[model samples]
Target: MAIPTIRVGLTAATRTMAGTSAVPKYSDKENGIIATDRETGEKLYTVMIFLMEEDRAETLKVTVPANGLPNGLKPGMPVKTVDLVARPWANLFNGQISSGVAYRVSALELDSGE
Candidate 1:
């Protein structure tokens, strides 16, 4: 039987580190998203990314479905990803500070031959 796959999108903005839970809870204002194949029904993967544009560092979180992911991706699987951070803020720190906004996309490879 062919594995199942699904696509999902999660926002990475407005992240607050909770004292508990290994993963940080992300809000919707960030508008982050993840996508996967629609044939395999597998678990989703979340990726946390940090970027520094000027001075302030921004935290971003993203998720991707791993239904047919290659080699059954684990928690520490190495995946290639890209980042887009928010622009610098004016009238603050002489343009040395920034809002710290960013987004990430994780493409999970599945094993299914679909």
Candidate 2:
């Protein structure tokens, strides 16, 4: 089944690079559980973005291609994401349900204005 992506806007949301880019929680080299792109087989990295909206504020951990993230991203620096999207995921494992919304972005840029 093809999952639909929901576009996310940062127009009224103030954002910042929360911390250094890191691998996903399931990424563990020792256990051979490294996370890779399902389509390209390329590795993936997660970026923490601090977002403040009108009624809600939370840090979003958005995934991006290993080579997609820009270099020299400083924490607390004003930033914006291009082609931001969210995908709802749910899986049944061990008779348990794991579900959440996953966020992704094509590019992350240091906001020069607005």
Give each model a TM-score: 0.29, 0.77
For model 2, the superposed segments whose C-alpha errors exceed 4 Å read 22-28, 54-56
Q: How many backbone clashes does candidate 1 have?
A: 23
Tens digits of per-residue lDDT for model 2, 9-113: 666545555565555545776887758787888778788888776777788898887767677776776677878899999999999999999998877877766
- In order, the Cα lDDT scores of the candidates are 0.37, 0.77
- TM-score of candidate 1 relative to the true fold: 0.29
Each model's Cα RMSD:
14.2, 2.6
Q: How big is the RMSD of model 2?
A: 2.6
lDDT of 1 by residue, 42-62 (tens): 345555544334446545454
